[model samples]
Target: MRLFPRAGPTASMVSATSIVVSGGIAVRGIGLLKLIYAAHVFGTSDAQDAFLEAFLLPSLLSDVLAAAVAPALIPALIRASTEGRTAGAVALYRAAFGAGLATTLVAALVLGLFFPFALPVLASGFGKEKSALTLRLLLVMLPLLPLTACNVLWRCILNAGNRFVLAALAPVATPLASLAVLYFGAARWGIQALAIGAVAGSAVEGILLAQGVYRLGYPLIPKLKGALNRLGPVLQQFGTILLSSVLFGCIPLIDNAMAAGLATGSLSVFGFGTKLATVILSLGPASIATGALPQLSRLAVVGDWRVMRGSLLHFGKLILLVTVPIVAVLMLFSGQLVRVVFQKGAFSTQAAYEVALVQRYSLLQVPLAVISALGFRLASSMAANELVIPAAGVGVAVAALADYQLRRILGVQGIALASVVTQLSVIATLGFLLKRRMSKQRLGVHTEAVPPGGDAL
Candidate 1:
């Protein structure tokens, strides 16, 4: 709620925030353009809905696995590299890559095989034709799980080394490739082109990111044998991170599934609205979290709780300053914004109105979601990841109950409202837990100023 901290902003905080926000602006800008293109080409059709459904599993799996691995790995990698444990960092990277690859491949194979059975349950309201289309698209996109897993790991490797530019920019390839395909080929190939473009884009992103990591001298090899043993700390934290990620990730999945049972294009509308809100998230909270985590990790490792707390408060204020106004503007002009960005070609006026309503409700969660993300990053840095599990459980439970009660009353808009409510609940819980934990520790009692060279953290 406060825009300025008592101690003012530190150079390190500004530098970290600047790096991430600059790159994130590019990433989210390209991503927004891609969504605009998608809306133009696909609108809110059943085909679009089917494609959205098809993408749900792979995206969820990729995100969950990436989220689990990256948080645990980045902090460990930071610690290892800072301690001059190059060999240890390399082994950790390799082990994480190996484990992530194995898990992704196994998931893809198993899901592909059983998708026929699972599709009905996931999209219980889909007609036979739409269900078949979704299945085909899903099978084609299964490879993305592994590709995304590798890409995410590569980015983590880069981020740990403070190579933020390449790590942040590599993902731009996805939207870029997707945009090209949709612009040139959407008319010729239809929604299938969207799927094809997604797979291709993922491949490009993964390859380029992996190459970036390789150029930095870390090979993307699966050296699981000794690597796993070497990365035991990361592995130890992995389970808790994985559980939290899966729980948080399921909120979107649950929303999409619930949307599937609604009107034909409800899922697509929700997807579009959420994607727009996520741009705000990417530009601020997500970028800040990614940039801040390594530094926080270093601080936590050296028992610098006072500085860590200041850093947390500084980042929180930064998020509040950026997000509060953006949310206000978005809520005010949700209709006009949707119309200007997406109401064209295949997208209609009615569709824009529906999506604008969803976007308005969804945007309410942006600030809270940003704060919650910062909390998670801080918790992870301190290896207090287990704290996130109960928080995520609470968020997901509240979201589910809210969705169940509200969707019936408000239709698709209810789902978006539920997300905002869920995030508010989670942030309150996590903030209380983190504050209690910080207060119990002895490190915050002193008022010593951080060293002049604190910028390097």
Candidate 2:
């Protein structure tokens, strides 16, 4: 069909939404394959530990940069396009893209410089050979940061333009392409080849999504307009988003590091558990959100609070239906799942037990996980006083305090438990804020619907 959402029957919306969400599942599936491959190929050795450890910072950076740019781009672009202000809309897109690129470059440079010293502090027990390999791999991954940042901007622009299928499918190309590299190039060139392939995939994905955005009439020009006064609010909002995104992204990384500190193999176990948790909790919910965000922003832009509220509730119910079974299955069969999936070859039976234990703890947050995700995105779209920062701040505080308390008592398992606790606390806070927003939306609807009773202007 077409790239943009169109006026059609109810079936059309269902079909389109399914296509987008299915495309996300496809990409996520390939990503899972890549993860399993990496874990298998790298084994549970110290080199693998150091490699995963070194990847934490870069992965976190990639997430924060993308998160910072995406929410603003979506709402801003949707507003510009809906108002038919083509020039203003295109300018905003360009500005957001440029901002993401610049921010990522600066972060990479600073992080790369400090990575060597930081590695020792985090994983001092790791052997010197593995540490050196990790440091080198990290430096290579640094460039991927800017590429990933640019890709996220383009992907957000595409989604804002109602090209959800294209945006969702864009990620699949990277993993599929990397699967090729992982199988062939990795054997010949080693981890460096795998790193190169990843960067290449990022570049390709960015270009494809950027082209899709252009075709959909969102300009990719790198020009800026308007006064500093206008730019100030946008930048301020992004700063909060960036901070929140960094913390949201860093929690798993921090948990993994703490686990590794407790024991060498803990990082691998934590990584495997996280991948499984994200597959259940993050991937599907993210897909639905990606499809719905443009429509949600459209409703918000015109002050149609009833439709916006309905949208949130509809998606919330879906998340609940999907997550409950996942949490149940995970908790009931964590050991069996780990053993079946990762207990072959070098991964070992002992490794399976550790990962299963972590999975059991991590699975507790499943239901609230879905709720908090919707709450965060809904708050970001509302953009009133920019709520993402406060919500994210609560998460960071919870994670820090819980990590300190639990890491001492339970070791690796304690870190996972702390994560569950932090996630629940954030969900509680986000639930309150979402309720307040809904209340205001309801009041506004009643106020608008009532007659004026002969009041003077």
Candidate with maximal TM-score: 1
lDDT value, candidate 2, whole model: 0.69
* Residue 68, model 2: Cα distance from true site in angstroms: 2.2
Worst 10 residues of 2 by lDDT: 448-457
Report the Cα lDDT for candidate 1: 0.79
Error of 2 at 10 (Å): 11
Model 1 off-target regions past 4 Å?
1-10, 381-383, 442-457
Q: How many residue pairs clash in each candidate?
A: 0, 0
In model 2, the runs with Cα more than 4 Å from the true position are 1-17, 218-221, 224-233, 377-387, 432-457
Per-model lDDT: 0.79, 0.69
For model 1, residues 388-452, the per-residue Cα lDDT tens digits are: 88899999899889998899999999999999899988988888887776665546653333221
How far out, in Å, is residue 170 in model 2?
A: 1.4
